[model samples]
Target: MRTIHTTSEEETCEAGKIIAAELRVGDVVLIDGPLGAGKTAFVRGLAEGLGADPRNVSSPTFTILQQYRGSMPLYHADLYRLAPAEVADLGLEETGLDGILAVEWPDRWTARPTVAYLVVIDDQGGDDRRIRIRR
Candidate 1:
């Protein structure tokens, strides 16, 4: 595990870019953070690093999931509004079958990937965020 303190949005996004550089196809990343945390910004950076257009990445909170193509494919999912019982209906695990699945509010899901990367972001009361990454 590695922990990083990001003082601003740019730093938070950079952290995501760093992670993206190391990602592989079929990777599942569990992301947990509160509202207004930089999860979406992080995903934007990740999209850029993976050779996709960062401007197109957004929180899939309402839509549930969004897909983008780059060096590989990226499947971003938001579980913030879903309950564990509803997760299976979405078949989210299959997101890893063809792309990198970055799931926000992953705790709402009952099952986890056998192997997964994780990123936890905590807002530190201001422009700062505590970001932890683990595999």
Candidate 2:
């Protein structure tokens, strides 16, 4: 486990980029944070690192999942609006068969992730986030 203090959103995104550089296909990144904690910003950095179109990545709160093709496929899932059981119904583990999965609000899902890069976002100060990355 590693804890990092990010003084700004750019630092938060840079942290995500570092993680993204280490990521390979079929990786599952679990992100937990409160509203406006830079979860989506982190995803944007992940998308950029994966060689995906960062501008295209957005909060998939309504859609549940969004797929992007890059060096490796990236499947972004948002469980914010779904219950645990409902999230299970989406078959995340199965979808993870092929591409790398970046999940926000992963606590809404009941199943244990086999290999998870857990990222916890903490509000340190105004526009600052303290992100802890645990393997």
Candidate 3:
């Protein structure tokens, strides 16, 4: 595991970009963070790094999941509102074959991807955040 500190939203996004560069198709990124913890900000940078518009990236908390085309596809999923049993109906496995999956609140899911990158964001109070990454 590794840790990074970000004092601003841009820095958080920049950290996401760094992480994104290391991603490949079939990669799964598991993110555990509280609301306002900059999870979406990280995804925006990830989308940007993959050649997609960062502005187009948003939390899929309401819609469940979203796909963005880039150098490769980005499958962003949010399981905040889902129950464990309902997670399977989303057909998340199919997304893994064709794009990178970045899942928020992955702890809610009973099954996880075979190979996943674990990222935990800890709010350091104010605007600072500590992002911990592991694979």
Instruction: Score residue 28 of candidate 1 by CA lDDT.
Output: 90
**lDDT per residue (tens digit) for residues 1-135 in model 1:** 999999998898899899999998889988889998998988988888898998888876468988888989988888888889998789886666876898888888888685898899999988989999999
Worst 10 residues of 1 by lDDT: 91-100
lDDT: the better of candidates 1 and 2: 1
Q: What is the C-alpha lDDT of each candidate?
A: 0.87, 0.85, 0.89
Deviation (Å) of 126 in candidate 2: 0.3
Candidate 3: tens digits of C-alpha lDDT, residues 1-135:
899999999999998899999998889998889998999898888899999889888876479998888999998898999998899888887775787999988987777875799889999999989999999
Total backbone clashes of candidate 1, pairs 3 or more residues apart or in separate chains: 0
The alpha-carbon root-mean-square deviation between model 3 and the true structure, to one decimal in Å, is 1.1
- Every model: Cα RMSD to truth: 1.2, 1.3, 1.1
lDDT for residue 84 in candidate 1, whole number 0-100: 93
**Candidate 3: deviation at residue 99, Å?**
1.5
Alpha carbon deviation, residue 95, candidate 3 (Å): 1.3
Using lDDT as the yardstick, the better of models 2 and 3 is 3
Question: What's the CA error at residue 80 for candidate 2, in Å?
Answer: 0.5
Give stretches of model 1 more than 4 Å off. Answer: none
Clashing pairs in 2: none
Highest-TM-score candidate: 3
Query: What's the lDDT for candidate 2?
Result: 0.85
